[model samples]
Target: MITGIDHVQIAIPRGQEELARTFYGDLLGMSEIAKPAALRRRGGCWFRSGAAFLHLGVEEPFTAAAKAHPAFLVDDLDGLQSRLVEAGHECVRSDGEIEGVLRFHTYDVFGNRVEFQQLCELG
Candidate 1:
């Protein structure tokens, strides 16, 4: 009994809220939405795309992903890469068939890796 992805959560070490906002909001252009009432005091942030949501949770020390992450699909890979670089974020290349799509990864300000994807036929 499984449905599609509900949301992807990442842990952000303390003292990096500003950086997270800049990267996820100002740079990446994802809309920042308020977390649920119960999670408001947690001190992190949430961002949403069309049908996907990313929950940035606050933790003592930032932890990298072992087998989890949010893979965001974009229409323009080159243009997106350019914008990310302009925003001072580096995109790392990866090898995989992600959702039957080609994609790459970039670390959020909190050192949490986020993936950017595009269909191979479109590239």
Candidate 2:
């Protein structure tokens, strides 16, 4: 039986490992995980933070997903949004009624959509 997700993979352009590392590691604060010996030569990187794992695989002629992306449940959504904005990235706010969730959307260097969400503040 499937217990949970092993990881979520997103494709990056060939020879863009450094950019991925900078964005996902330094910027996003995710720790880089070592790939298996066999997989190392394939050209890619893996990362983990807490229980979340994200794999960035190399793809030639890569195309970023506009609508399709992953939504992470963050502890401090406002802080992350501010960080991303201060880094010269765009942060779009959501005005929809999605229960008690507060969220924002942003894009990676590759133009892939990324969502950050947290529970709405109780007043």
Candidate 3:
């Protein structure tokens, strides 16, 4: 039986590791994890924060996932949003469809859609 997700993989154009590092590492605050030796030649990078892992794989003829994305649960949603904006990333606030969830979507350097959310505390 499937218990939980191990990691989420996103496709990126080849030779963009530095860009990934700057965005996912510097901007998003995720730590880079080394890929296995066998997988090193494949040209990609991995990152982890707490229990969440994201793998960015190099793809030829790459196409960004504009519609589909990974929604990350965050603690300081407003601060993150500000950081993204100051760094020139546009944060699109979500409509109140999920109820009690404050969220926003932004595109990465490669145009992959990403979502960040924070849950509201109930009184």
Q: Number of the top candidate by lDDT?
A: 3
What are the per-model numbers of colliding residue pairs? 0, 0, 0
lDDT of 1 by residue, 1-94 (tens): 8878888888887667777888888888889998889987878889997887888888876676744677788888778888888878888766
**Which of the numbered candidates is closest to the native, going by highest TM-score?**
3
Q: Rate the local accuracy (lDDT) of all candidates.
A: 0.79, 0.88, 0.95
Off by over 4 Å in 2: 121-123
Each model's TM-score, in the order given? Answer: 0.83, 0.92, 0.97
- Per-residue lDDT of 15-112 in model 2, one digit per residue for the tens? 88999998889988999999999999879899998888999998878999789887788898889988999999999988355877889999999988
Better of 1 and 3 by TM-score: 3
Clashing pairs in 2: none
Clashes of 1: 0
Ranking by TM-score: 3, 2, 1
Per-residue C-alpha lDDT of model 3 across residues 7-106, encoded as one tens digit per residue: 9999999999999999999999999999999999999899999888999999899999999999999999999999999999999998476878989999
The regions of model 1 sitting more than 4 angstroms off are 95-100
